[model samples]
Target: MRFCILGLVEVQDERSGLRVLPTGAKQRALLAALVVKAGHEISARRLIDELWGGHPPANAANALQIHVARLRRLLSGPAERDADQPERRPWIETTGHGYALRLSPAETDAARFQHLTDQGRRALLHDPGQAGELLGQALSLWRGPALQGSVLGDICADEATRLDEHRLAALEMRYDAYLRTGRHGEITGELVDLTLQHPTRERFYDLLMVALYRCGRQAEALAVYERARTRMRHELGVEPGPALRELMRRILHHDPALARTPGPRPADPSQPRATPAPADDAALSLGDEMARLHRRIERLQREQDQLLRCFRELTASAAQRDMSVNWEGS
Candidate 1:
């Protein structure tokens, strides 16, 4: 059987693909809590608390037992066991203190998604192309917000937050891989949307700037940085981080290192691949010298603006003095 919690809570029989979801809200909540933390035994009191929040019914324990029994029967199927048929093991086992729901890693999409994202991240530094593929697969599993169907108790809410965090991390990693592989032109639009959605995240701004700069949209890249700075200052009362500032400096000077490199050729799956040479920090640190230069440029520009204003004032004052002198002579 496979359980889905990415969107609605659903349990599908592996053989028939039939959905066997509990009808009642409390039953569904109980199931959701167990499924999210599947493989661990949840105490009876904890399950009761999740189902009823602060106030539980006088017969809450009895009600929980009834729900557990119904779920067990549904999972076991309706076929009558005969003398010839082997004894069926229970899916929901009764523990000493509470109940535990046993499910394989493949049975739940959330677990599978986590597994794939972890694997993808591990391979990210060495095999970014493969990492992108795996992370993409992990993201595709989510149809909407996690556990959209059931009311979220504390446990369910925590699980949802954890899954969402993983989802965002995977997306960021995939985009980083895409940028590294010279797909800047393609990712710029999506990065624009991501920046709008998560303006506080400096990494998204950095990636967007890089993509725009690489695509010959240098002015737009600078504009993005300005927007980020404004948003950050207005919202968080802080400036953009160092990496993003460094990237801005690079774009200002038209750094050739910002130009995209030809991505590595796709390796054959059957062949044992040689290790790639350690990559240079050119893409990352090429702007170290430029950072100081950019700071100086900004200081000079400010000074120039002050000088120009002083010059204009002095010229106006001299004209007035000449007019006064001519009138006095007359």
Candidate 2:
């Protein structure tokens, strides 16, 4: 049998590809914990603690034994059992004070994912091209949220959070590889969505601005900075950090620094200056100022229109009242 734990927890038969394990909540939790901590022996007492969180029933040990027995029976097929004691067989091995799921490292998807991620990271440090492919392989192992159909308590919740962060790190590494290969334009949409989902991650915002600038959308890159700056100030009551501010400065000055190295760097303390001819710099600055003024004008125009509408309604009501009074006088 094989265990799938990159997403939902499931146990499948190797030959028939059928899920032989029970789908009960407790059973699924038990399987999830085992998969996350694979190749290690988890004590029954620890299992009970995880399942019940220190409020176990009086017969908790007996209940756990029954559950383990059920899981073993489901995993053990008829071909492996003797006719004399078919119902009392054990598939989970008994250790000194715990039970261990007997499976090879290759039988678990979580294990495979971690292996591929490690290989990918190593490859990234050596060859970015090969690293992208390895990272892609690692990402493909995730079917959805880790342990998606299982009941997650404290331990499982922490494991799930760690797995999610690992996945994000892998994605960032893959995007780095893409940027190294000059595929920034192709990744702009994905980076945009990521920024929307995680608005506070400065690295994603930096990548997005770089992608936009590289794609010859300098104006859009500036807009991205404005948005990120606004979000940071509104949500966190602070301006963009040094790294993001440096990126914005580069964009504003049209500095060659925008296309420098692929890795992250600390913000240079010196102020950036426009490198183009004086006439060109003047034109770019004029255009930027015009855009800013146009935005302010639009906002004022909207407010003026609302005020005019209200005034016209009040004037019509006053006119109607005067006509009624004149009719009554006649």
TM-score of each: 0.73, 0.71
The global Cα lDDT (0 to 1) of model 1 is 0.78
Which residue runs does candidate 1 get wrong by more than 4 Å?
78-88, 262-330
lDDT per model vs. reference: 0.78, 0.75
Q: Model 2, 136-218: lDDT tens per residue?
A: 99999898898786654665777888888888888888888877656787899999999899887788888888877777677
For each of the candidates, the C-alpha root-mean-square deviation to the true structure, in angstroms, is: 10.8, 10.8
1-330, model 1: which lDDT tens digit per residue? 677888878777656557777777776777788887788999999988888888889998898898899878866762223123334346688999899887666679998898999988987777777888998999999988887757647888888888878788888988988876667878989999999999999989988887877766666777788789889989999988889888887777766677754345675699875332222355335344445655797799799999999999999999999999999999
CA error at residue 159 for candidate 1, angstroms: 1.0
Clash pairs of candidate 1? none
Show the lowest summed lDDT stretch of 10 residues, model 2. 273-282
